[model samples]
Target: MLRFLNCRCLLLAGLLLLAPTVQAARTILIFGDSLSAGYGIRQDAAWPALLAKRLHEKSLDYNVVNASISGETTSGGRARIDAALSRYSPQVVVLALGANDGLRGLPLAQLRDNLTAIVASAQSRKARVLLVGQRVPPNYGAYAIGFHDVFGAVARARKAALVDFLLDGVATQPKLFQADNLHPTAEAQPLLLDNVWRGLAPLLE
Candidate 1:
């Protein structure tokens, strides 16, 4: 009888230990730019928020933290990453940066290095990374192509999933962009979430 009681107690303790692991929410950190920050729109209308809503709609156990700042560059992201990582303790980090750097015609090598370091830093914390690429405006000329390639190259090197062109469906589409032609309009938020979700959902499972 004592042996039976001991076995039941051990089984209960094992189930208790597994309960928290099964119910814990997965955390995703969106470390991005003005686009993700909802530059001119309300914060709740941003892509990150929309993504969170979508996750809820699907009944997924997850939470999203938006760490986007308008006009953020790779350098700026790298500088602030430690704090962001520390605060969020994310299981996954969505790295969407370098658009401002490309706009400023920053060197591609510098962008590559910054991005590589950022990915490595996140990996060191055992967090999975998803890199979101951005294309520079055509006015930047040949340098723009090179700048854009930095994202794919870094992602390939780091073995991180890449979301080619975060603004794929909205960029250069006047109807989807704000008056300045730099930010996505609220109407475009859903598509942006779709773009991110395509790359993010697979890794989540």
Candidate 2:
């Protein structure tokens, strides 16, 4: 009986010692703008939230941190990147900005510079990156084309993952958007998750 009790105590101690390792899941930071921040939709209905559920369903050990802010531009993201990096220390960073920059018709060079800086910062920390792309209306003509290409240019130069456009399918459909015609409705969140997953999945391993 004494021997059995000692064995049981040792087993319990072993589990206690291993508990933190089992729970210390790596972090995935969704660093983006209004789209990722769930603008005009319930926080739970956002794609980032769905990502957490999907990770759990797949039994992937990762904790997600949605550190996005609505109206975030590449410049704004650059300003905050260091603080965010120091705070989360994420293993993966879903870098989604420049939409607001495109919308505002900011200089394409400005967009490219800020994006390069943001990706470089994350890479410096050894964090994998999924750089989400954005585009302005065709009415902007050459400027819009330049804006769209900047995301890819930065991604290639930095060797980060790229999602060509976050709202690729949803953007074409009027019904998928909110009243403001900028944000996607709650129903479109899953589709957004699907698009992001393509780029994100590759970096998970």
Candidate 3:
């Protein structure tokens, strides 16, 4: 009987010792567009999933919640920001939108305003924000430049972490993109995650 009691106590103590690690797991909310939604590839092959795997490998204890959708714009993300924030209560909110807006030639000012609102909302909730920048082809000229500039402007004003361009290494490689030429191929997911990790790692710490 004494042996049984000692064994139970040891088990309880062990569990207690392990409890903090389990409870310390925080969430990272990835809010973005098609690039992050894993557009033409399997969901597990997307950067968000890759990020989760990397975090686990590094023993970071972060839960990555990817709330991305194909063709989503900044206004669309703004509309849903509140609900997402309330639902996830994330420790870090990765704001990666505005690509579709630039592609569609939406007003750069509108894009900036919407993105600013999203960042402000996330920050208000005490979630750290990582603003992922994007760029359009030079053909759009001034519109493209203005659109690309929004990411940095918003990040600077809000004091969020900035990933200057999500497609840094992949953009130059045609094979890294899907046939549509906009979304990334499965092979490019890790590269995308790497770009994001450079900005996100500091926040995780």
Candidate 4:
């Protein structure tokens, strides 16, 4: 009886050990820019880091990879996407680029094309994409409007989920913005995570 009971306990332990491995966790990749990179903040204080914490709180099994680089443009994102995709093999990719392109006055057409290619590449790898939009400073004039439209257009064309503006809540709010008035303050990280979670939670389900 003792031997039989020991065997049963071992079997239960084996099952327990296999449970988490049997179900692979989903991975979400944030392919973005300075805003997403936590520019002046500690790495753990970034929105992506907060997002991972949020996921944990909700008991979701996911790996959030922040591949954001400060000053990265749509073209830069497109160039490095293949490597990111290969390394992360994410189930979802948050495409949040193009702001730098607009800042530099790069042709909107080129920006559009770069984003389109990035989306297509992710899709080809069977990854669902969430396009995160941005608004250029008003000084860019009509170009700012055009820049803002690019994300929606691409999302519509590709049938991807669109987060109209990644900085929706903090953009105009002085307290939420950092000294440079570009990136959000660390205190606003949760709200930023909330914005992303609203669009991302459904995809996980």
lDDT of 3: 0.79
Candidate 2 lowest-lDDT run of ten: 1-10
- Candidate 3, residues 93-194: lDDT per residue as tens digits? 999888878877888889999999999999999999999998877777898778888899999998999999988887778777776666688999999999
Worst window of 10 by summed lDDT in candidate 4: 1-10
Clashing pairs in 1: none
Q: By TM-score, highest first, what's the ranking?
A: 2, 3, 1, 4
Question: Tens-digit lDDT track for model 4 on 160-201?
Answer: 888887777677677776665556779988887778877777
The TM-score values for the models, in the order shown, are: 0.86, 0.88, 0.87, 0.86
Q: How many collisions per candidate?
A: 0, 0, 0, 0
Per-residue CA lDDT of model 1 for 148-180, tens digit only, reads 888999999999999998888777577887666
Q: Cα miss at 41, model 1 (Å)?
A: 0.6
Global fold similarity of model 1 (TM-score): 0.86
Q: Please give the distance, in angstroms, between residue 177's alpha carbon in candidate 4 and its true position after superposition.
A: 2.1
Ranked by TM-score, the better of candidates 1 and 3 is 3
Off by over 4 Å in 1: 1-24
| Residue pairs clashing, model 2 | none
Candidate 4 lDDT at 193 equals 78
TM-score of 4: 0.86
